[model samples]
Target: MQELLEEALATLVPSDAEQAAVAALCDSLLARARKAAPDGVEPLLVGSVAKGTWLPGADIDLFLRFPEGADLKTEGLALARAVLPDGEELYAQHPYLRGSVEGYSIDAVPCFAISDPTQPASAVDRTVFHTSWVHDNLTDAQRNDVRLAKRFLAVAGAYGAAAAVGGFSGYLVEVLVHRAGDFPAFVEKVASWRPPVALGAVPGAPEAEITLPDPVDPGRNVAAGVMRDGLARAVLAARQFLAESTADAFVVGAAERKPLGCVTTVVLPHPGGVEETALPHIQRQGRKLVRALEPFGVLGSHCSLGNEGFIVLETAVVELPERQLHRGPAVWDAGAFEFLAAYPQAPLRDGRFWALKPPRHLDIASAVQALLPKARVVEGLADGAEPLPAA
Candidate 1:
């Protein structure tokens, strides 16, 4: 295990030259930001880069901290734009500039300076506190463990906490690694986690599959974004890694998907917006479609968005009986009369009213098309659609 970890670290850790290049780039960007900012606005480095836990190609996060009353929307944007004139503006809680500088992607976010993480002035105000907490608490060995944990999660397809990925965030990884003492220990703990997992005693922390209270902000759950399937993937990956006991576990590979039924893929035009703002809606729409196709024996569904949106549904049966037995209200209930009045042919059996009615959709493709009027439903997997794993 030690040898495997060392080998993995050798490949994961940044070389001296790479470190020097990143340092130079950060210094130059910071200088440009500071020169562009007005009085009372302080520019500082943040994220994985600032904490020295960044991967080789990780994007640099440069935040411009404004004073109590500074206009972050206008003045902060102007300062960021002044530093990177060609940067594109992207929106989160507010607007930020995203652009490339000397081959490295950089995000120039403007946030209000705050002394308390719990009482953040803006959405990103807690980032500075997160960076400081990691820097102050994690030892050198633990930092390396964080790197390994990140690599493991990435390989397992559970590293990001974006709307699309719905996996572990970098900060969450750091906290878990620090608490577990090392990567192996962290894996052991994760492998045993049953969902609704709470890491600390945080009162009124939002209920989630996994809940880890933010150390800096007790009110916030760092793991709230983790999806149930993503958590399962991490748990399975950890168990597999422990069983294999090999360095090969760190390598990225496609997960083998065994379909439980006939697959149908639906392609739809992407609703125009940033992915972070648009993907949840897409997922929700896909889930609604899945529910609509339940009569056709839909086993599971997966949604992905890129140039277009793709929803894949796996169904045990592609076609359903034309006439389905629709259960109505109990025979003794007030609604039973209404049900009989509506159906006129509904029969009462075992104290309940049941009606044999022809369903609106008899096939998966038709059901998908009916549910999503604009969807292009394919009989099987679409050109770029991914299949869901077997249940």
Candidate 2:
């Protein structure tokens, strides 16, 4: 296990040239930001690079820290735009700039650079402080453990705390590694986790399937965003990786939802006019479609970057028949008459009201499209984008 892990670290760790390039990029961004930044504002390069846990070819996160008097959004955007003129203005807790620098992706985010970590004003404001905490607690050897843990979670399809990924974050994995003492130990612990696992100084009912509290902020749940299915997959992966100890168990790839039936592709035109911003929403929308498809017996799905600038979801379910029976409450129930009235021809059978419901739509894509107008059923899809690939 140790030998395989070392091999993985060799491949996953950033190369010296890549490090130099990222450092130069960060320095350049800081240099550009200092000129346009408001008074008393500071530029800080945070994330894995700062903590020495970054992977090869990973994006750089450069944040502009502002004083209380500074308009963080405006000043940060100004600084970022000055650096990357065509940068798109994005938002999370606060507005930030996202663009490419010399073919490498960069996120120029803004946050309140507070004096104390415990007194952060916003969610992301404590990230740098968290990075510092990890750096202080982790040794050079432990950083390797973090990298191994990250790859393990990622391969298990339970990595990333993004809205789309809804799994574990690199930082969360790092904390797990620290607590468990090493990568292999971390796997052993996760493999032993019962559902609703909580780890912290104080543990109670878990807020999520597995609860791992933020070390810096005890009140905050670091694993709050992790979904049950993803965590289950990670648990399974840990067991499998323990048994196998093979590199294949830690492959860098997206986890595909297991297929249940004939796959249906839901394609939407590129929403953001650009790929990076649009792709997340596309993947998110695909997950939403899968959720909506559950009632129709859809089991799982896979999202993809479709050809011709479209976002695609190849799902595991297809359309039902043109019409189906909808069972209603008992004849004496309050809503029974209402169901009869709505269906008009609904009849009592075995003391229950039954109605032959009209089809939502004969075509699955059309059904999804019709539903989208009444409700934005998906997180990433913009209004008016249609689903495609009939039948």
Candidate 3:
């Protein structure tokens, strides 16, 4: 296993030239941000690029530091403009500009440069502490561990915090490797992971989907963005890799195609929005779609898109009956009167009501088609978008 991991790292580790080129871009952006920054403030380089744990083709994150209680919207945007004039504006807690520079995607974010991690002025303020901690603590052996872990996750389609991936972030993987002692140990730990895997000395009921407390901020979870589906897939990957204990398992990813007998492509029209904005919107829509299909027994589903305003849902599911059970309000509730009026023959089950009514959709295709009119049906479901219903 150790030999396999070492071999993987040899190929996974970014070449010196690749790292140098990326570093130069970060240094240039940092210098530019610092130059634009006001007196007593400077730009701090952060992210995987700064910590020397980045893989090839990683984005550059340059944060302009400001004092606490500073108007980051005003100060940050101004410095971002000064550093790089042309870029797309993005928003989370505050506004930041993002664009490509020297063939590399760059985010010129402005955040509070505070010394303490506990009291972050903004959402990104704790990033400084995370970067510092990882840099200072990650050993040479552990860095390679991270490389192997990231490569494994990447191949398994369980790597990234981006809405599109919703898997593991490099930082989270680093935390896991650091906590588990090595790459192989991390895999061993993950093989035994249940749905909501918590790590790094977190307390509570482990209720928040997946809780990985930030080492810098004990109250915050670093793995909050991880979608449960992604974690499940990663867990499966870990078990499989461990069972095989081969390097090949960490390199190739085989798509799990939905059963052809009852599978379909739901091409949802896009709003032709920006990539950054459209992706999160699409991911949210995917969640909504899967939930809507749960009653019909959706075996599996995934979101895929290739063009403008184009989203596809490959879903496998059991067929919806002509009459589906719809739950009604509580017996004593005021809304129960209206609900009973809608379904006059509804049975009073316990304190609640239940009704067998005509399903809006006869099958999977029709269900998705029905969803087109109600949900974020910006452009509506595609013309041939069909849902595969199970018998």
Candidate that scores best on TM-score: 1
**How accurate locally, in lDDT, is each candidate?**
0.85, 0.71, 0.73
- lDDT value, residue 132 of candidate 2: 85
Per-model TM-score versus the true fold: 0.89, 0.77, 0.78
lDDT tens digits, residue span 1-391, model 2? 7788888889888888888988888888889888888778788888888888887777788888887656766676777677778887887777887888788888888788788765646777888878888888998888988877787777776788864456888788888888999888888998898778867643553467767668887767777878776688788888887777788766765334443355444556556534435667666766666676654665455444544223333444456776788889998888877887788787778999887766666655666676454322232332333332111
Better of 1 and 3 by TM-score: 1
- lDDT digits (tens) for residues 20-41 of candidate 3: 8877777788778777789867
**Which candidate achieves the best lDDT against the true structure?**
1
What digit string (tens of lDDT, one per residue) describes model 1 on residues 286-316? 8898778778777788888778888888888
10 residues in a row with least lDDT, candidate 3: 382-391
Q: How do these models rank on TM-score, best leading? A: 1, 3, 2
RMSD of 3: 5.8
Candidate 1: the clashing residue pairs are: none
- Kindly give the number of clashing pairs for every candidate: 0, 0, 2
Which has the better TM-score: candidate 1, or candidate 2? 1
Shift in Å, residue 40, candidate 1: 1.1
